[model samples]
Target chain A: MSRHRLTVVISQAAGKHPVKRALEEALVAALIMESGLDVSVIPSLYDLSPDHTGRLFLESVHGDMVVLSWLFPRAAFWLLDRDGIKGHLGETLLKPAADDDDDDGEPEAPRGIGAVDVPERHIYCIDLRDAATHDPFIDEVRRIAAECRTRREEKDRAASKPMMVELGTSLTANGTNGTNGVIGEHAATMPTFTAEQLLQAPGRRWYPVIDYSRCTNCMECIDFCLFGVYGVDGLERIAVENQDNCKRGCPACSRVCPEQAIMFPDYKTPAIAGAPVGAIGSLKIDLTRLFGGEAKDAVAQAVAERDRELVADGRDAVGMSVGIAKRQADKPQGPKDDLDNLMDALDSMDL
Target chain B: MGSVSEPLTFMMGKYPAVLPAELRYARNHMWCRAADGRARFGFSSYAVRLMQDVYFLDWQVNVGDVLEVKQSIGHIETSKAQSDLFAPIAGKLAVINEELLKDPSAINVDNHGTGWLFDMEHAEGGDAGTMSVQEYYQFLEANWENTQRILKGQI
Candidate 1:
């Protein structure tokens, strides 16, 4: 019999980058074959709608889950929650240190979008980019499985806590009702994956996650994205209609977004990689301030990038002629250097 | 390749290992020292270095049970991560390391000596898949960069 019903989900990347693909396969192999886990190789978390097979499988799972995905941990959590796989984010030791402002520096778990009607389970969403190989994942999975086993055992013991009090004048005996000197009934096991099985995968992934919590319907993303990745729904609200159309390496529209709400999740840059905008030590802050125009420079750079890609696609570069609007200034820069002092002084208004 | 007999820790400088030639190694970074069909195994210095500070170690297999290669025998937990111990060689489990079990930090302190994990009677010949000390050192050298990236949590 299996020790505990722990599942490992490999939420794969959309584009078939050999390195990412190889890592995903390696993780599945190590976990399924070695770690005594039920492994599911699913398509991109961002791409799975509520009715998708991958989402259906996720919805069926009852036990603790460890999701290894390419997206940022918070982004993955929200996507899973939105798909009805509700769970509190399980802690993982396998992640980069939080920016110092976090105080406890605990990983910021994005709050649930709405009240969860169904019971929440435990889910550990680990970033695929956190480890170079599968060892850390295997280690963490084994650890969690062991803890789950311990908790189950403790619950079983606790279920037997109250013994029937023998009083002279008390209750009539029923053969089924705690007849064995104990009042508490043992907890019935919940249905979970009793045997290990690997779920089939589409083997492709990559798309932007719109943080609608941060998004205003400015339509700048739809205006700036030359690749047709963004579109409008029936409400005229922004939607990621043609997700597959998003360029693999492009985050141009994310920069063009006035709200800073578009998250690539897999991108190396922290803010665009789903960290909160204005997060301390974010590289995006420096990039915006690099040319001192704050708002104009970032927009110009994004438009220029869009133009380069346009030219690469053999179309005319529509630099600023399209998606032309004043962008919001980035939040204040980090601790000042001499260059920042000079720039801040020059930009200051004379009263 | 310098001297298959030389201990790897001599050249470790920073990459940390005390891989004596007589010892064989598992890809998981455990070291086995075998002589006259009586074999002893422990975590290599490299594995301990990766572990950093050890907090807990426990065995699943009782003394006198037989273990097959890749079968999980026990697990060790530390601040960094919890690692399950897999058998690198098929053998009959013999002497368990009682003292090291009490103080898991012995692994970080003297992994090759007093911190030896367990003993086993051999399974006829040898573990075919394990690397010689020299080969293991080279393996560590090759994977060092990848290991660094793993430590940094970078893609």
Candidate 2:
């Protein structure tokens, strides 16, 4: 069978442990498997240099599905318009109203599977957090797979024209310049902070500190960070566009900052202390307590009682003396009669 | 061979260092060995440590089946997630470990030994191109640091 490609993009900050990465990978794989689709898990797309983030976005546009696990509001806005693709994840989940059809006779299309102007192929995007919490996420993926299969079958029968399809992720916090405004102008805009603002000694949410003394204005940190945290002010000063939307621990902007101007005090602290002990390795069972020392005798007694009940009900027909005696009397003559019939047929046919 | 008392001496000091090696490392953290020219493979200790508890092992390829490099051979289910295991090298699968199908926890207990997944005969000249033990350690170090940065939102 030919291989079908499905690309998964996990947008997370750098510095996560291998265990967490493995957990995320396993979760995504399980979701894919629940849909009953054959999948090949790709190595992760790790921290992209600011210069490379745009190129990476372009490359990721080729996937059948693109998943944005974290809340990168600005990045979602920027990637809405690029053509030659299926549906988007953030756009569908974050703003379901952006979808044109309310009743397509399908459950809310999974994150990636929907119609783009280009073709009938569907792309799905899932919010990692939402997927972790909601059982519906699994159900939705299965539904989307069914829909895609149905659509594909119909297209094959009708000999419909093939459509070009691509999937992508938008990393910029502010919406890209195109059909959808950055940060979604129509939706109720939430407060967000740039990495620079977040790094400026955690305090009040507004008026994020932009260290003009170390500002390079390269916009690299802005490009790398998914949240539209950094923007140029009227006086050409780098400023925080939105602060409230920033997740408490994500410091993507500071990691990408070449100038080292952006700094946050509590940003890098671990959510939990110590190396996490794996849950599976610590499993314990007390069978002795569950089933006392007389378990073997009890099992034997139960088996004996079950056998006696079956014999009394004549359900053990094969083991009955009368049944065995009848079989023994008929067995020899049954095969001999079959052989005689075969010989008679051969003789009559003059073989 | 070392003396039997060596264990006591080592235990008194510290356990033998089980460094993450490169020779047996898969991109997904599995290991491979060449046995009589056939590739014997299993999950690395690091992979088991990462996965924690393996409840189920599901294989995609069957015996006498040809597999390509980077192909997904099967998946292992853990409490947290279902992780796919990729074929590090291309070859025809010779046999699978029936024990893992019956008792998957063997992988977490003795990942390098009785927990091996399958044996494969190289198709033509299929080579795993795996790293040495030292190289794998370096890879893990780099990967660990990168993962940390991503988690911290630094990258």
Candidate 3:
């Protein structure tokens, strides 16, 4: 075994999001039996608390880490930071396609690579949507592990000699100079990770992660959500309380949040899946409502999508009866399309 | 009356999709314009109007990748659906509109101009299966109902 194993965090998806499940399963099945990796499957990272057992175990590690979760890279990076697992964001060449592939300009390593308690350690936060299939994921993980081994080997040379000299002095003082005694002391440094050491329990959870940067605390989400997935904290700010109460595959609540703050990171659609397209323009779930495209209004579509899930779940369709509120200045108008301008022109005549 | 719903009907009253006479069109609703023997590609206005809104787009192929006709080069995503973008003409990808990846709604705003998908180098057999603007419109009229079904998610 290597001197220190890199912890690979597999944050399990909440609902049976089929593609997420399939890719996650493929990854876990392939990686679990590997010797060098310390793999742990915790519940969704978005819902994790700093005090959670799994998170505490994660923080205890003084080495490299990899986090696989259903979140945008930006969201996932901040989520890890929120959970007290901090490291420089590891760059992955694997995007669906990166905006700029050339790395010639930024030649040096990012500023804070080894400037901490753990030198040369990084947190490779891989979005499950980073690729379509598991081969890319598998290749990336193996590559990361190999890179970690190389870093450790380089660090060991500089750090190991001083430790050995110090150990000799301590051993002589204790009159334990035998080869077996040295062997025993060295063996004590070997890391111990068993099935029970992983702190978090396994449970499927699905919920919205409020990007507080964008959330205006409008309570529009709380008002719009039929399920009790959202609630207020002591200060009455929105929080995802009762996350599992979120209806599976029903992203209707996301469509209704006028601020576009809600993100179902595992959700299939890019904006809902937490792609950083932008705040307002990207999150406009019904972009057609701007131009003369959509047949139904935003609220109507959301209600229909929500009601389908409700009916499927053997519940009554609320159908705009509950959680429907008139939003004020709901959407910031982009420069009007020709259609919008025409509609404005016609509406002025009041025909 | 064609009575085709959405984009087609919606476009009929105001600023219908104008097909440039010089451009060549693939049956899959992609347009290819030749510049200095290289082909520049994008979604046709009809295709863009049919899509309604483009929320996100990502290329599946790299800039240097050699592609074949009908090969899914990337996908364009709107609020409701994600559709693969097939290569309109087969050649090595010379340039992709990286700007459009950031804000794919540009496709909805200007599918013909700044919203072009990619360019191909030393592109081959440009006239093979492509049609002129009139012929493409004829093809649309011929397959109007089936095309309507596709747009309506029935097929």
Error of 3 at A285 (Å): 14
Tens-digit lDDT string for candidate 2 (A1-351): 111233334443234545446656665666655423423322221222222332234233432444444322222212222212234332243322212333322322123212224333345554443433334444555555555556555765676554333233333343232322332221112122333322222232211223333445766555544445667657655656665545454443553444444444222111111001111111221111111112222223323333454455565522222211132346454555332443333233210
State TM-scores per candidate.
0.44, 0.29, 0.44
Poorest lDDT segment (10 consecutive residues) of candidate 2 chain B: B4-13
Candidate 1 per-residue lDDT, tens place, A1-351, comes to 124457778888877778899998888778866534667787778767555667766876656788988877767875675466777667776754423333332334433123244443478888887777878888888887787667656765777552323323323232231223332221112223222222344444567777655667788888778788888877776878887787776788888776667777766556677864444332212211111123234577688778878888899998878876654445555788543443444344110
User: Highest lDDT, which number?
Assistant: 1
- Global lDDT of model 2: 0.44
Distance from true location, Cα of A52 in model 2, Å: 55
Task: List the candidate 3 regions with Cα displacement exceeding 4 Å.
Answer: A1-6, A10-64, A69-71, A74-93, A98-123, A128-204, A279-294, A307-351, B1-155
lDDT of 3 by residue, A1-351 (tens): 235566788877766666688888888888876656667777677656545656665665546788888777656764665355667767665665323323322322222212123223688888776677878877888888888777767877767642422211122223232333333222233233344544355454466766554667778778887778889876767777777788876788888876556677767666676666332222323222112122444578789888887888799988988888765357566788543543443333211
DockQ of candidate 1 relative to the true structure: 0.01
Candidate 1 local lDDT, B1-155, one digit each (tens)? 57766676624445545677878987667788877777788888777766667877888899999988666677676655555577667778989999977788888888889889988887765655678877777777765654543344311
Candidate 3, pairs of clashing residues: A14-A205
Q: Which scores greater on lDDT, model 1 or model 3?
A: 1
What tier of docking accuracy does candidate 2 attain?
incorrect
